[model samples]
Target: MENWSENHNDFIDYERDEKNKKIHILIIYDISENKTRTKLVKFLLGYGYRVQKSAFEAIVTKSQLKKIIKNISNYLDEENDSIRIYRMYYDDVIIFGKNFSIEDEEIIII
Candidate 1:
């Protein structure tokens, strides 16, 4: 929303646009290897919230999305692993089973 293509190098300054608001990312993956799956989960945890065993929800900017995809690509086995990244608007998301919500505060895992 903040002209990400022009300011690709400065992701820290990326801001949400009034039109787009927030970028909600839903990540779903299936990896045959246990170790790879664990590593993938760990990597994703740094950038998102795990809503399920193999799914995650994140609020990210365009540059951050690019970086996350690049990181995920490195761990994926083209032949056996599958990863899906769904980009949607915050208002478009619908949650049923669990009470999940995105917070504006920083999450610290200690």
Candidate 2:
């Protein structure tokens, strides 16, 4: 298994140009400005669910991910804010937790 370093790109690349395949993404961030953080939260809600006060989980394609990253890069305070993104395929992860609910691209209409 290959690990990532600061000098290396750690993002995933599926064979056969699987840009349309949906994958899980975890986004965590910390911003010093309240207004910026709040705005970012609102923006991210369109793409995923908020799993924590400062963390979110999203299922998106490679193109959507690129767009999300690009949009957020504009206002991020690189010197005072920090953000991390982790991606995993459905079969690439194992979960062990308490009362965890899975969020898929499902629509529940009553």
Candidate 3:
């Protein structure tokens, strides 16, 4: 999660968006080392809920997201690890499953 990710562009401050407004961030990581991965997970957990085994979703301010990226970068081995972060809206998400509910909401089984 840096300025060089091919899957994402640089973190841009949208001109239309207000400064300090909170936004949803989805972070998914694949690290080769278990220790590093575990540490990253622990750090991320303090910021948001874990959506899956290796993914986390947080509602953080732009500065908070930037801080996360800055701090986590130190623990990353870019040659062997991959971490992707996306900015999205919580309402845009739809679920289709059982036994999994975000923020204690009921899960829809279809």
Pick out the ten consecutive residues of candidate 1 with the lowest summed lDDT: 1-10
Q: State the lDDT of candidate 1 residue by residue for 20-81, as single tens digits.
A: 54457789999989999999988888778898988998876555677776567766898888
In model 1, state the lDDT of residue 52: 90
TM value for model 3: 0.74
Please say which candidate is ahead in lDDT: 1 or 3: 1
Give the least accurate 10-residue stretch of model 3, judged by summed lDDT: 101-110
By TM-score, the best candidate is 3
Candidate 1's TM-score reads: 0.74
Candidate 3 lDDT by residue in tens digits, 6-105: 3232463544335446667789999999999988988887777888898888777666666677677765898999888787766788877743434522
Candidate numbers sorted by lDDT from highest down: 1, 3, 2
List TM-score per model, in order.
0.74, 0.71, 0.74
Candidate 2 lDDT trough over 10 residues, lowest sum: 1-10
Model 2 C-alpha lDDT per residue in residues 6-73, reported as the tens digit of each score? 22223645452365567688889988999999888888888888877888888876666666766775
For residue 4, give model 2's deviation from the true position in Å: 15
The clash numbers for all candidates, in the given order, read 0, 0, 0
By TM-score, the better pick of 1 and 3 is 3
Residue 28, candidate 2: alpha-carbon lDDT: 95
Q: Give the residue spans of candidate 3 off by over 4 A.
A: 1-12, 15-20, 98-110
38 Cα displacement, candidate 3 (Å): 0.7
